[model samples]
Target: MKTFDHLSVIGLREWIGLPELGIDRVRAKVDSGAKTSALHASDIVTFYRDGETWVRFKAHTGTRRHPRDVECEARLVSFRRVRSSNGQLQERHVIRTDLVLGDQRWPVDFTLTCRESMRYRVLLGCSAMLDGQLVINPGQRFVQGFPQTDRTLRG
Candidate 1:
């Protein structure tokens, strides 16, 4: 077995468990083609929370129903127009938060968007995969499953 001091530039797409958020087996795509990571969300509404910039959006954590729509909020850090895979540029709201992957955890900037068509719910891009923090195993799936704890900490 080989031990890695730092993640290789290839394994960023492997399955990551966000146990703190009760998200398990979320298939993410590591895309160097994008500048900001994207999470599948719906019914996105921007609002003010505690007199601070915030946004409320729905998230699906690879489940059928029950607690399907998750309302998440984060400080409005910035918004930028990013070109999509199909060459259609769209403006997206970016938020910074802590992401846990395998034995590694770090702050990541995620762009909020309605990704109803994309196969994978989460798209980990270059901006998030920087600093050799992740190693994507293209031939692997669910490197680790998230714990079944509904610790929904608001971002």
Candidate 2:
């Protein structure tokens, strides 16, 4: 009998894309230690737009000084309490969305948080890296395409 394998195993840093949100070539940290994927978001405000539930938040991609507030309409999935590396437990907003890694795309749940100090704005966790797909090379950076230069123009 053969044991089924899942996920090609990725390194700490890798390039990822959120095609559903029109984001391409965004740097993401693959942290198996984390249970849920996290995205750097600030000033998170949830409101109704066009009679639909939507969320508006600011995100700092490449730099912490420069933050871009992006508005995305996502269905509220669940609320979870997560503990940070510093041992701080906080309630976070989780939403289900699509993520593109290498040549594969799948649905993933991302938590909203203000990760201003982190190097990468996007952090992909274990649940998001399932199915024996992504293989992250630690020594390698930007395995696929180049990162986007303009965050304001992400549409």
| Model 2, span 22-126: residue lDDT tens | 566567887877889998877777877677666666655565565554545576677799997779999988877777665556789989897877878898887
Which candidate should be chosen as best, given lDDT against the real structure? 2
Stretches of candidate 1 off by over 4 Å are: 1-4, 8-12, 17-25, 63-67, 144-155
**Alpha carbon lDDT of residue 34, candidate 1?**
78
Q: Write the per-residue lDDT of candidate 1 for residues 5-111, one digit (tens) a residue.
A: 66643454456544433454466777877778887777777888788887777777563433355667667788989887778989998877667665456678778
Candidate 2: C-alpha RMSD after superposition: 4.5
